[model samples]
Target: MNEDTARLSLKIERLEALLAVTKAMVTQHDLDKLLDIIAHEAANIVGAERASIFLVTSDRRALTSKIAIGMEETGLAFSIDAGIAGYVARTGEVIVSDDPYGDERFNPRIDEETGFKTFNLATVPMYGTDEKKPGPLGVFEVLNKKDGDFSEEDLEILLALSGQAAVAIENARLLAELRLAQDKLDRENTRLRQRFLKEYAFENIIGIAPAMTELLSLASRVAESTANILITGESGTGKDLLARAIHGRSPRAEGPFVALNCAALPESLLEAELFGIEKGVATGVEERDGKIAQAAGGTLFLDEIGDMSLATQSKVLRVLQEREFTRVGGSETVRVDIRVIAATNKDLKAEIEAERFREDLFYRLDVVELCLPSLRERREDIPLLAEHFLEVYRLKSEKDIKGMSQEAHDVLVSYTWPGNVRELQNEIERAVALAKPGETIGQEILSEKVRAAAPSPLRPMADAVRALETGLIARALKESEGNKAAAAKLLGLSREGLRKKMARYEIKL
Candidate 1:
């Protein structure tokens, strides 16, 4: 071939080789492996003895070798302002050095350490797509050209290789970051699932009273079934908690547990929230799935179902009956497979008699009814629940509180918690906040209403008298600072008589 034709042939060969490098890079996702491939290809294409690709550190303070060819050890690093490679990285220029040792910009320490002689070398800057990087990503360097000193053709080849290598490096980094983020998200999701299961376990409900025990036994039995359930109780009586425990124990434990309060939204909005809305259903409203769709293959907890409007109740009834629903302003009939667990603080029977709630909807939801006892009805569980809350709040607040004083326990047990178990939980949390570190929660830290609560006059005479006597004795002890003689004097009784009464009432200081 003539000189010009030979040159054209070489150029075409180089171009084809670079195309192969690009194709190889596209398939390689591992950052370390990709860098090794790029370095090997660059050296082969340019007939170099060895090659190295250095990358800018995250802090942009230095460059470290990502792939070093013909070297037993890798990760050779130096300041970004130091060598010929640094110069190309800083200036975004290609450098061809026939005598690298003679070049002022070349650092010979690397040669001394590795015991490798460098006759000639070519360095090219690698540019990346990140605008945040103030300079080139790093430098691509090839050492000791085999035939002679590195040539202009060799520099051009290195430049093309560097460009492709830069893109490949960026893609590898992005892929690595995405995998890390996904791994972190997966760990977080697993942690949340574990926490959810622990929180809603049936044994963690904190009720041991006979009323609660019977209720829990029955609830646990029905939890495995697919029947719709209605939970009726006063507000804060743990209806929501029981529903969650049921879901966590059921066959749908792996599925979602979606909750919506029927009283929280108006009729139109509640209907849309339950059944979802179509795209362009209203101006600026995007299409979205509702709670029903979200609860597919899971459980839907409808809190305060008695408060749902009759119009919405009728739609919910259709869903329970036909196992399908249509989104508002949409014609698509969406089918669902979800267990419905509805709760209400209101008396649905009374509401039905008053012609407010639909009787048929009530019947559908009430397939299995579970009535949670009010906190007062299960007062024997108070101390256990209080201690549970104490430990929880102590850890949360990082306090050193040990337990509740007998006076505090008596007050908690005596008080009729109108807000039920939720109120007791809040009360304990409050007492914990007000209590001093290393001290027991005292009646003094309790809310004034709790401190001064007396038995209702409607209680049986003996029970009412016993509660009154207990309150008076507790107050006397508090006034006298646990001095039995002074407390008895204040209460018009001998110290021995007071001790006997204290024994009978199980009162401890």
Candidate 2:
């Protein structure tokens, strides 16, 4: 073929290759795949043995190659002003070098690390559409052309390809960022759901008050130990519930949790109940294990432990001290591996002074004492507990109650909860049961006892009592026909004292 025809055919083939690569670049959105395709196509179209696409980092301090054909691996990086690609990326200029080893801009470390020799290489800056500034995106390079050094035609084709490469790279980068953000959102949503289930579980015990938060923190810490625990609080303060929470948080959560109320049974029955019963020990009684045996490898919670008789306390002390006990009639010694959590509303110290409780037993069970605050002490938690109970009973009763009214919340927070959380829960449950569908709980739905405990007007008690006295005295005078002497007699005050009393009470008569 003639030189003119051969050159024309070569130009046509180069144009077709450019068109095909541009289509391929736009179609592939995956950044890595696009980079690989771009690198290989640039090398093949330029008749070179190696090629690489290096993007400028966000900081613009370095260039990073995501794909480098003929290299052992990719992710090669170099300073933006140090190497040939770096110079092109920094200065936004096309660079062609036949003696790359002699060029001062060439970096030899990359060639040494990758074990590749470059006889000639052409580098062109990839720029975005914005021409107001440098607008350079990266450096695209083809190294060691097979037939001869890269010509001006090859440089022009690469420059055009660099423009298309810039846009495709930017789109792929944006898509990668969006995917990362979506994955983070999905992980956060999953974490929140798990946290809700854990914190809102019936056995988890919910409280936002600082005191309650601290108390639960202590409970979790203590749960790691096998020490005996004494939980002290007023009746209805949920000591039993807290004990269960400790058990659930402990390592023995999968084991049995045996609960027994010391006061629920009589002294004789309590001892037999605690120490188990052998067959024939009682009339028609079969062999049975007590709470201690049933709680082996787990936790045993003794509720109302203060109510237990001294004799029973002695037996309990023996078990705690020796870790061994025998049934009521059996001679076989039964040893147990268990944690004991004892709870009571009564003050054992006072009981000891009264000679009603065993001091030794009290010491045995008081290894770790966790005193639960009364509801009145942690009044800030009332609203939270109320809402929790509201949701609980709403679900239980299949009601549509969504929340509690402000007035209802006021009533709850103002009331002195003598019975503590147990009373609050019951109050909220009753309110939820009585509340209309889709209606919030209101003060009217609360039980009379809670409503009656609402605080009176904020005033000094002395002033309020004096006001009452004045009203009573004035009423007596009106009934006594405004006769001070008659009113004084009715009030059981001397006539002389009557004048002083009337003056103090501010009575007209």
Candidate 3:
């Protein structure tokens, strides 16, 4: 063939090859594998034996290979500025050599390592569209051009391929980083969930008020016993905290503390979650030991026991009576030595009267009983709880927020906390996290949903006591009708008790 005719045929073939590389890149965009392929393919298209892709790293001084082909089995990384590839990556341009030995860009060290002599060579920068300052996605090179030396046509093809290669490489890198970030976020969310369960309900049992003190003392006493303990309280009154605290203090503290909220899960789910199931025992073949078995020698805190379905309540009653249960899907009877600490924010006596709760189960669990007080009943404990939550949020948020000021403390002390300790804790936590650095929490820090917007401090005891004393004296006189003995009944006091209070307040009626 003549020189022009041969050259025309070669150009068509090169275009086809370039199309093949571009098609292959679309099908497979995995960075490491693609780099290896691009290195070898670029070499083949240019009529060369070996090629390497060197990428610009975070520190822009040097270019490093994501991978190298036609070298040894060992992984290799080299610089673009130090060698021909390095020089191209640093300058963001192409470097070509007709005679590698004659060119300053050629490094003899790589030739020594690969045991392959490089003759005519060319390097082009792979530029990513994602970057502001375009760094090298890779360095595309041809080791030896065929039929004497490479031409401007070969260089154009390489540059065109380099542009496509840069986008593909950048896309792959972004995808990998995105996946890594997603995995990290998922792991962190899981950790936060675990920590929430560990700390929020179980760790926080707030207040030292008389009502709370009695409840905690009873819980501690009951923790020494293996009997089924029943707890009743208002919703959000820390019933579960009492149960978990008993479990945490019990002999089973070292064992698993498997707790289930009966109100949280439906009957079918709760049953499966509580009981063991065998592999292939039903559809979706896998075996799972129930929460009862999971608790084994530990304590199983059954929260919101009133919400348990009748059928589940019957099964639970049997477990209390017989200390055994069958798995939801398996018939084998399993006996668990779990210390049952049950809690409800509902009154079982009322539930039983309403025929919603079983009498037998109530009595069985009622072997030991404790009741937590509502936050309104413990107004004096609010300041302590608020401060506690402040410290907790301060550490959790990694902030420098100081504690609530004296005015804030007084407001917390006297305001009727309708949402209870948990609400107070959340309020303080929110306030502390939102507070500016070195700022003390004020009334503004509080959630207006709690105390009305622009909340004022509580009414002083001095301002309130006069009305309180007058009401008591009037009630005493109304009930007694000038006799203290009968008035004591209406006043919920002994005659002597009534007299002492009346004298203290200096009531005249």
Backbone clash count for every predicted candidate, in the order shown: 0, 0, 5
Model 3 residue 377 CA deviation (Å) reads: 1.0
- CA-RMSD of model 1: 11.2
Model 2 lDDT tens row, 1-509: 69999889878877887787678876776777877777777888889998889888888888888778877668788888788999888888789999999999999888888888889999998887657545488888999999988899898888877876887877777788899999998798667645643653344687777777888888889987888999999998888888877876777765667899999999889878898999998789999999889999988999999999888888888889999888888999999988899999999999999999999999989999989889888888888888888888989999898688888888899999888898888888788778899887788889898788666768999998888878778887888999888988888888888788777766663
Regions of candidate 3 where Cα sits further than 4 Å from its true position: 1-206, 453-509
Report residue 348 deviation for candidate 1 (angstroms).
3.9
- TM-score of every model versus the real structure: 0.74, 0.54, 0.50
For model 3, how big is the CA root-mean-square deviation? 12.6
Residue-level lDDT tens digits of model 1 in 370-471: 999999999999999999989999999999998888878888999999999889999999998998899988888999999888344366888877999999
lDDT by residue for model 3 (79-194), tens: 54577777777777777777788877678887787787887887888888866766665677777766678778778878887776787777887899999999999898777645
Residue 403, model 1, lDDT: 85
Question: Comparing 1 and 3 by TM-score, which wins?
Answer: 1
Number of the top TM-score candidate: 1
Off by over 4 Å in 1: 1-12, 70-73, 147-157, 225-228, 267-298, 310-339, 349-367, 386-416, 427-509
How high is the lDDT of residue 205 in model 1? 93
